[model samples]
Target: MQVAYDYEYQLAVADYWQGRPTMEPNVWVPSLPLQMTVAVPASNTDLVVSSGGQQELKLAVMEESTEYQHERSNPMEDFEKAARAFEDDLQKMQTKMHLFPPSMKGEELSKYSEPKVVSIGPYHHGKGEAIPQMESTKYAAACHFINESGRSVEEVYGAVFAVADEARRCYDADKLRLLSDNDFKPMMFYDGCFLLQYMLFMCRDNNDEDHPIADLPWVVVDKLMKLMPKPGLDMETFVGRVKQCLQTRRHLKFDPPILDESYKPPHLLGLLRFYIVGSTDSSTTDDGSGQGLSDNAKKVSLSVSVIELAEMGIRLTADKTTAEINKMRVTRGWFTGKLFLPPVSLDDANARFLVNMAAFELCITPDFGEVDDTMSTVCAYLCLLGMVTDNDTDVQELRKKHILQGGGLTNEDALELFTGLEKHLRPGNCYYNTIVAIENYRSDRRLWIKLYRFGYRNQTAIIAVLTTIAGIAGFLGTLKSFQ
Candidate 1:
């Protein structure tokens, strides 16, 4: 793609313009016009099952991925979003819009960092007197005031946002420096250009010898804010959008959306990027249109993603489960390949086989994604309705009520329960969106117990059956006799 010939070079008399037949003289170098690309790194999983104890359950996280590897490298913020907010306010103020009754000079804006510039604002921020744990609430209240009354020069007593506008008139950057020098904290900035705009406002308000503005990271905030939405709307939605904006740069991003996608947290690009990737091997592709993917691949991918989620959720529920099982500490027992489940964790995750099955079973079972709570529920439900391929012995023992706690049921038991619950578990009955059905059977609990419970695939099948039956009946009456 280098310049083969420069038509301009031929027409130009100057030697400087001499080049290939139809390109500029500088066009033939070690580069091409930049093109976009998606970046994907391979997945890595390390597994260990210990008997006496888990020697290496802990693994440190990887370093942050900064790869700009995207199909499009658009900056998170467009041009207009990067423009200063308060500075825009200042311009209007000069035209008698009165953002301030008395104007603050550009030099006065620099002294905002002084520490001595403390506040006893128009309202008590609480206490006789140091405020505690009420920053965001107070900040929001102040913002509302500024939006309403900052324009009215005649207004003296008003909300913090309006008065804050006037406070900026006497701002000093030096006082902000004292706040930073003394290590003042709880200093957060709005995500986008608001940080710089806020900085200018604070700098102009220096009624002290210290500068709090010096401590805030205006530059980094400035960079990130471009992608952030304007603040007039809701905070919750805005936070989620900021997360997605940064996540557009991650490696694990997939085109196909998952049924149960993880919630993207605000500004955590690192974790969000890793969330979407599946552990399944993509290096090789099978035409899995008919029979679907091999069992091994499904297990591997599902296990990794699910385990990642469980690790987050288990903090409250699984701590006891882990501690109870760990007491046995059968290191040598691990080689025998038995993953025994407590009656509790079994129900919690529906006894996923990888964790409970022996190494011998592990060899037979495909490496699906980690046994997440949802997947386990789905699997357990299938086993109950006889949809799962086979029966399990340990589960049967539970259904027999041999355990300390009862309410255990087998797959058939679950089916009967769901069938009995048809009316009770219908659309707004037991839950939202989830279809109630009995997937498996437990010996102790009555079948009706599961009638109002949830099932994913079974309900889907039920809908499909009804649709098919309706179609068949409609067509049968229309056919000619023996035709």
Candidate 2:
């Protein structure tokens, strides 16, 4: 409509002047403001046409309908019922912590959690490359140990097979589903004998060659190399393999033979941890036996960083000479603290073994994150190390302080090795009491150092300030005397 008005004005001017409107000075050209609009149809049945329209209207239809309610819902009531059921189920399921801790179940840490060179327990009984190679070796060790007792391999198999069901009960249920009773017996028999023989060999005199393991291929190769006139065996490969096996094997030392029939370990790794933990002095190892110490820390407290600890007069030292992993000693005095970390050589093999041992300990523990007395001390020790050494710098500091045996690992690798080791690792009641003491000691020592340094630097200024105040007082008295 606005466009039509503008067009009409232009036509009237053109007809009057006989030409288009000129843009001369003091002359005005007529125009209309442009407005765009869309036309809407009216609902009336009678159509009324207009020459000009004032505004545009859009037509729309709104339909009316009825809504019905099928049912009423109380969501809060249903949620409360579900929550109560969940609590009950959680309490019921809390009894069994699986042999493999859920934290260690991921693929990123599987190599550390699974057996590599050897699988001793039923959890990793028959899965990998290690099984085939170690199976025959285990049988040989079994034969040698059984023959010493005047029992044949057949008798040992029968004996272990008889107790297969009981052994199965010791392991968590999920791992042994694929293995049958028939499979369980042989594996246990072979593994049990191997462990027993190895324990027996370690307990024997160092020079004793009568032990059965000396008859194995690698041991044979070692012996023959010593006796033969010419270079009998290629010393490199076999020697390295033997060296690795020795290091990777769980238990290194045996004091009293760990063959007490009264206490049956769950599996081979369990047996190893049993022995390792048993070797620690009862005074040092915190079994959470009592109500707990009077000064026991109420919360988890890791030590400060290595350099910070050293500055506080706390010394870090590695127990490189100690063979047992569970043996850690902490000593404190008024002015200083000492932490004797057990020697740890992290490589692929031992890291896996340690992780599996910790997982096994976690599984057997009836309740995690409590002060349980019967937990594995090895797990406790690993947790302590994990707490103390957090990163590459910590690892390097420990190495420099002789508190870590690198085991051919760089600082970065050692850092990764200890990473996430403490996740879901709750300390037992008596666990880390000594560390807590050390932490308290360091805190006190640091405070003292700060105070001492402050006084030492400001004492001269203090004397000078006192002298100036005295001089000012004398001048005031003289002025009063003059008045």
How high is the CA lDDT of each candidate model? 0.26, 0.51
Candidate 1 scores a C-alpha RMSD against the true structure in Å of: 31.9
lDDT of 1 by residue, 393-475 (tens): 32353334322123333554433332322211111111110111111111112233244233332567778888999988877
Tens digits of per-residue lDDT, candidate 2, 338-386, equal 6666665565555665666677666656464563433656567767666
TM-score of 2: 0.54
Give candidate 2 misplaced runs (Cα > 4 Å).
1-98, 106-108, 139-149, 152-154, 197-264, 278-303, 319-330, 345-349, 368-376, 430-432, 442-446, 451-483
Considering summed lDDT, which 10 consecutive residues are worst modelled in model 2? 210-219
For candidate 1, the per-residue lDDT at 50 reads 79
> Which pairs clash in the backbone of model 2?
318-402, 318-403, 371-429
TM-score of model 1 (CA atoms): 0.15
Residue-level error in angstroms, candidate 1, position 178? 61
